[model samples]
Target chain A: MNTSDAFHRYTKKVCGQIRWKKAHDIVSREIENHLHDQRDAYMAQGDTESVAEEKALLQMGDAVSVGMALDQTHRPSPQWAMIGLVMLLSGIGAIIQFCYYDNALAAAPAGNISIARFAFALPLGILLFAAAYFLDFSFIGKYPYLLPVALLGIDIVAQLIGVDFNGKNWLSIGRFAISPISLSLPFPLAFCGLLYHFRHKRNGYLLGGLFAAFFCVQLVCFHTMSGLFVFVCAAGSLMLFAAVRGCFPGNTKRLFLLFVVAGIVLFAMFLWANSYYAYRMNTLFAVFRPETDPQNVGYFPLLLRNIMEHSVFWGKGNPLEIADYSAILYSGNFRADFLLTFLSYEYGWGIAMFLVLLLTGFLAFGLHKAFRQKSILGQMVSLSILCTFAGEVFVYILNNLGYPLIAPIALPFLSYGTTALLLHMALAGILLSTFRTGEVFRDKELLTFLKPPLFQWDNGKLIISFKG
Target chain B: MTMDKTLLAGSTAMLILKLLDGQDMYGYQMIAELAKRSDDTFHLKAGTLYPLLHGLEKKKLLESYEKQTDSARIRKYYRLTPKGKKHLHEKTEEWEVFSHAIHQVLKGGLCCEHI
Candidate 1:
């Protein structure tokens, strides 16, 4: 057999026995190249072609032994450390959710809905995580149109039958309740797929990105202002990514002008749309003009500032019990609005900082791994998801850090909303699966850890040591 | 000689890390360099070296990337990571202490012999 043929037979014998079959191609290619190089070196020694091939093959030692050693090297091992960290963060948040809602369940006629939803949402989120982890994350990219199609479908349905909740329409499914606007959570992945598909065609890139942004705005305008803000921030990050890769239209200088002009137009149109959005602007304006709408629009901001005035390094934590019912209830019902104020007023800033650090760690590592991916599809999806994570965390913290609460973003690990919990967990699972798939890159490393070294010992005396 | 085939197993990873400490090289280059430096006393077959190089990469002690040469062939290069360099330094110190002990024993120069 030719050198190439012999190398293939050897690789098949070894890699075929390994369970992580995805790694066979890389291993086979690498080993074949090695064998060919060796055979050439032998030919330089003036050996005949067949003899050189034979000697080169022989130098590799036993075929079965080498295959087995390689097979031991390429096994798939899950990263439990990161998974554990995510679980711990989520668990702490769930505990706090339970404590607050459980205590308030007796006093409030709403029957502690926040705590109940958070508790039920945790397991569902985990189930989503498990499913996403096992299933290939690239499935989102497989049908690149899936996320956008799904988003448009949800938006249409919500418009048709969505019910009003706290001035915004929320879609309910039979007995189950869900906010249609929150469905925008997965929009980034779909948007990334669009960008990935049109990464070459500059026109398609611009059109697809703008179309994706418009759809996100459509979903947000009908439901929540915060959704629109989050979506815009995420889209901007993706644009920056595309610009850096030279995928954006014309140059980045033009793109910056487009952003400013678009911002002004959107701001003008947003205020003119409805009294609901106008009222939100008034709330923002109330931040500076405190006397503008005292006892109404400006009330919560005043309450937040008062709460911040008594800041401690470590938070008091979620109140043991809602001692001052009027504290949260009477001042424009700031239960959800001032979540940070409540958190700092109860838990301490330390918990908030810790939660943010944990999430930042997860997102940072996930992005780092994804960027390392050689495939553009992988990088796009990873960047999209990471951008979403960063956007949510940043916006939420900004709103809390003495800024007018323009939006109430659900913290990754600490928030109590079912929609937010489920969405975060699902995205998290996708990131984890991507990281797991990265194992195929280190097939050589996996084999090393999969099997222990062979050591011969007689009464604890070292006789032979085989590393692989 | 046949029995000593397994002798390279335990130290193969360590040796590979040492070679990759400052310089980056691929599988074939590593084998040829190791053989050349050891004066042909060590023969690291293609099979043995590839697996060991890959294993070190998996452990994250070494990282690999491919470079394109003028010959139009892509050669995969390996380098020591910070973790790997620290490991190599520790192992070098360990090997010295271990070999020094072995040398003392072989020369019948153990202090315990006087006792």
Candidate 2:
């Protein structure tokens, strides 16, 4: 078959495979409309019926290429990256808190794991998916502004009544320990809404400012080194967005002066925020001095050694085996070793290398798309996701290699946590949205749709019907 | 044309409500009727029409049913709920007031320019 005929067949096959009903219909109609136009052109040129049909198919191009182009429309956005980063970081933070701070073996805190399981992970996952599907709907989209406000208001009211549900504190309601942060899953969702609004509005600068403000607020609330690291990563991602968009303020001198002033202010705030900074600084120093607090500082090193000695290549079936081996080998406490130790013990070096290559590929592809897309919204969204992952992967590696400054951040898709899962899904959704809206796909579809009679409305209505 | 575009988009819910107000019609019939009424000025694209229809259905403004047509093809037909009529009435009033104000402004501007 000719390339065009092959392309047409590919398009039909791929369009049939699209899972989302709306997306599938949109793509199928577009392809059919293009094919119809080609047929009409061939007929107008005085070709015989069969010859016109064959020529039309040939001119329309390859189906797989067209299908691939159409498929890009559903790729996720930078918000997904930000979500993944936060979720992974938060999951790692929770794990760290549990292993080191919470005394996990001490009676298990009277319904802690159950609350973590049912309240946090399960409900949050469901809520994230629901929000993703409903984001574009009018009723859902129109009043989504109220969601974050309502969540924040409810959290405040609950707090006033001495009820805590954020998983920070355990509250017993009959048989269960209910956490409110379970409901706060929608806050990140609010960020997604905000991102979409700003993206459509073409307000990249505002998006960056909002991201910075949100990161600062998170840092203040968490008051941990990991939180600050995430904040920095978020800021860096936003800056990358700004730089990509060329939306930086025009007055370079003034902007520089403003940055200098801001830097000074931040430095002063850092000094004022001594407790948090001091804790981070101490931890950083402790990385070098493994004996400083062996339970905390030397824990990962001992665990890594045990994993290496016992089974350097696929050490154990259970990830927790590293902890068991460390306790026995170094007479150290059983804390969750950082992700690197978990990797070495559980999967082996091959898996780790594979994961690195996969992550590198994802980041490279994401960055390439970001740089190529002209739309500031698309570019910023893509870049933000790439930077967030880059920062996350870097920090995770640093933490594992005896730099033990911050808690481990989960690798996207691989780590277990409601926050991570939701975040990845959100990022994927955003990228998909961007890919759908990209200029190349837009132009091709626009050309097909703009043909005479197609663009002509029948008294303010579209002429075609998919059902027919 | 602009007025029609606004009316069509703004009154999409109203159009669906009005169409369903009388009797049930599948998406194809609804589009054909919409085109015929508008004198072929607004031909509804399936992409645009279906989403709006589905959105309205989801909001319970319209109810849909699947039945075998005479041609033996299963067709989904939509009919207006009472809630949809109420919504349409509210939207119609809003649109009338909005369009009247717009018309007055444009007419006044033309008269002033003539003077």
Candidate 3:
């Protein structure tokens, strides 16, 4: 039986009262079905078709009232606890700069510019975060190709004409040099969009792998092993998750095994091909034997180890009577790379442990929220964001503890880099956005209907049907 | 005999939960079952039922899934979650205590005819 015009008008009116567009389709469909069932029942009781529909419409009660109720329940609520944690972390980062590094920064000519730049970057980073938080993240899926292509194009342009900063190409953005390599930070998000786009196609995983290779190459070309490591971990996990979730078009287990094997082989090849990476690995192993080479590669680690060894748990460690105190303070990128060491040396190891635990707890909470999402896209996006943040913290802590496996990536909100600060803020925005709208974002392409089982017993068969 | 709308309104969520405790049910089916079980005393509006159901779902107290009925009509069915079941048990206990108190106060060992 066809639904009458009156039924359509009623549902439309009800949907109009719902402020959230995402909830409209679901609410409309459920209401439509309820109306149909009522109309059918009335018609069975000898009512005319028109009369039944009219009665059904009337019995549903006021459309506006129902819509208003649904609107109240359907609206996306911000994750206040997560937001508070983010703000707290960002504040700690700012405090680290102004309190510990301020005098050191003021003493140098470029430090004045750095401090001014940090002052400029803080609120600007918060604004970028706000913008990202309020943004409709569904646009990532809608224009899957455009985002990656644009980011890659920017990187290419930056490489060709950008200023060289510390042996890496950086786009000069008016007194602020932005690392084009950091542009790869959102590759996991872009990759998710591409996965959604190619969900129905054959060898889509291959395309995803190829896309990852391209970004990984960009990170490699820039010699940012930390960025490369982070991108691979975040984006690689996203791909693996998409496959496990059956968002791709092949045998899931086979694809999973293939990914694992490919990852191992490529990683081996990468390590073998790069002598610098090999040296970094060798240095990582040398961490335990820092005393053996105390004057060369182990100089800083040994210095750090000695300070930590002497440092008390709660208060200031023994007075700094070292002859090379200036050398320790003026180490390369001391504010960003060795801030944790300085923090521990001055304030005590307790604070350092607390900071690490706080960061770990925050990331764990984020991952938990991400896993609870009903939408695969939200899960993938959240995983990437959390992975990047967690990976940075892990590397920072490891390097701080005298392990120096790779150069220290910024410790997310606590580090003193404008670019990194801005990136963290923006990523926080995306993470908050995912948590805010996580439930309502159903990837339409991924809504697969499973065929019910057909049973046969003694030549009698029961066939189950599924319709899209 | 129809109950007061206010009384029915207060108990609608509990009644719905009780009805679904036995089996998963669609919106229309729940409404019909409520009326039948209440001997036509309950007349739940579709408008009220859906919003209530959705609110419960948002709280993770209920979960909904779509499946085709035997009659070839696609129906969205609601199932009570573990949380919802726990809630129902608590509500039932609270209701029993309140109703028993009301009964004792109203009777007071005196017949209505004497009054």
Highest DockQ against the true fold, candidate: 3
Candidate 3 per-residue lDDT over residues A1-468, each given as its tens digit: 345457768889999998988777677767888998999899999998788998999899999998998888998878889888888989998987776555453323233335667788899998998898988777767788987887777777878878776667777667776655455566666666786676657877777777777666666775477777777778778877878788777686769765976587558646754767766765765787888777777777777677677677888777656768546644445756877777787788898888888898899999889997877778877888898887778778877877776676688888766677888899889888988987777666423322223432322645433332
Model-by-model DockQ, in order? 0.38, 0.01, 0.53
Model 2, stretches more than 4 Å misplaced? A1-211, A222-224, A265-269, A276-279, A291-311, A314-325, A328-337, A436-468, B1-115
**B5-106 per-residue lDDT for model 2 (tens digits):** 655666676776777778898765676687788787766644355556756765668866545445333455788888888998888899888877787798
TM-score of each: 0.79, 0.47, 0.87
Give the worst 10-residue stretch by lDDT in candidate 1 chain A: A103-112
Q: What TM-score does candidate 1 get on C-alpha atoms?
A: 0.79
Clashing pairs in 3: none
RMSD of each: 9.8, 22.2, 5.6
In candidate 1, clashing pairs total 15
Relative to the real complex, the DockQ score for model 1 comes to: 0.38
The regions of model 3 sitting more than 4 angstroms off are A1-4, A41-48, A100-113, A320-322, A329-332, A446-468, B22-24, B36-40, B63-77, B106-115
Q: Write the per-residue lDDT of candidate 1 for residues B16-110, one digit (tens) a residue.
A: 88878779998888889888887776788777887787788788888876665554445678889999999999998998888788788887887
Q: Report the poorest 10 consecutive residues by lDDT, candidate 3 chain A.
A: A450-459
